[model samples]
Target: MTFQAGGSFDIDAWDADKPYDERDGTKLTRVSVRKTFHGDLVGTSTTELITVESSAGPVAYVGIEHVQGILHGREGTFVLQHSAGSEDGTPGTQWLRWLIVPTSGTGELAGIRGVGQITVTEDGAHTWTLEYSLD
Candidate 1:
């Protein structure tokens, strides 16, 4: 079975630093983010991301996100793996995939698997939709 969860989140904290420039003209940067969610689910999440920037534009990034909170009254914790990219800086040109780590769910959310998408509006509001299931 599958269920849908929709919500908006606020970035409680964000810190990004440009670490070092690689020899291949790719600049690598590290970013840490924290968020608080509201709507069908209420919780907090922390993410560690490594962004790769190429000469053409923003290239790709991979990150691990740890989320703790309640989803539809079920409390638990889980991890999401992030792999996403943008070919160019064009509007609506970015894509992202967030996958729930196998067997990473805890509490009532144990055995959860899902995929989610996030959209940031032009005004900077962040919204998310998650299609998931729990066994």
Candidate 2:
């Protein structure tokens, strides 16, 4: 099934982290993602690349890396550490977020234990979404 959704995110490195100005220029972002799933048990994960363009500026592409755990009963969870920096994308803008989600074991996951530095965006707002993808 093909899907389309709109969302936003908030990034706060830390109350007292390095690069103070970076902490201030910090802005919330909204994005939309679409993917196609291939049917297969013990399905393989396809790489997802995202780039966001807001009315305020240029396109900001996200460079993400994920390490997923094993699948249990056609469902599994993956822990991902995403950093928003790439010489091939936006410059002077960086971010980091962690994600945990239920695996369709095929495509994009929903009903997530969305934590770390990431949140789901909807109707131009952001919120944490979690449902525990594993036991």
Candidate 3:
């Protein structure tokens, strides 16, 4: 059966390295982030990201996040592959999506498969929604 989950998350830590590559007015950097999930999902996550920034500000990022916690009432862990980007560095022009890594679920989350998205509110709050199923 498929299930839906929604919640907000707090960014506990964000450590970004100085630009490792810069050319044509664009910069690339590596960032490590930690977050605590709340609401329907309860747990913490660590994410590693490669981000690209232009003179217009953040343009894109790709990341892998390992989340360990309880979803709804099941306790386990899973991985999310993130792909996000903005055409003009505007919230309204961005797309932030998550793909559950196949076979990456553990414990009660085993066999989970789904896709999700992240929304950043104007006030800078981060919220998320997931549509998934477990075998």
Candidate 4:
């Protein structure tokens, strides 16, 4: 739960939520900032369309990302928080997924790199908050 930034982070009540299974579940969160180098970051990504193998996987979920608003030398990437789990209100009792990876390239970022974390809550949603710095 530590980011690669040069300082310590104390995120205060940054709330985020999504609808699932005909209900809205509330979640608790915390973040450790790794980088805060300034610049506007703009990019897109795609998830690997996963299918339920057993009685696992989410019933439903949505992606609400926070793209890093920083860059350096016209190069940067993002860490997509591909978090998923069973929409059944029970956590640690099921298989939850936390996939963290760097964003693909284009434009000012031809071959940039970044790293971040993805957190999954038992209430039926997840969060992805990452930072990007020059390589």
Every candidate's lDDT = 0.88, 0.34, 0.98, 0.37
Model 1, poorest ten-residue lDDT window?
A: 88-97
TM-score of each: 0.91, 0.24, 0.99, 0.34
lDDT of 3 by residue, 40-79 (tens): 8999999999999999999999999999999989999999
State candidate 3's TM-score: 0.99
Off by over 4 Å in 1: none
> Highest lDDT, which number?
3
* Candidate 4 local lDDT, 1-135, one digit each (tens): 232422222233333333222313343222222322321333333332222222333443333333343343353444444454455534554443323344554455434455544444555343444454433
Model 2 — TM-score against the truth? Answer: 0.24
When summed lDDT is taken over every stretch of 10 residues in candidate 2, the lowest stretch is 12-21
Q: How many backbone clashes does candidate 3 have?
A: 0
Find the 10 residues in a row with the least total lDDT in model 4: 30-39
Backbone clash pairs for candidate 2 read 7-121, 8-121, 112-130
Task: Say which candidate scores most in TM-score.
Answer: 3
Residue pairs in steric clash, candidate 3? none
How far is 14's C-alpha from truth in model 3 (Å)? 0.5
Off by over 4 Å in 3: none
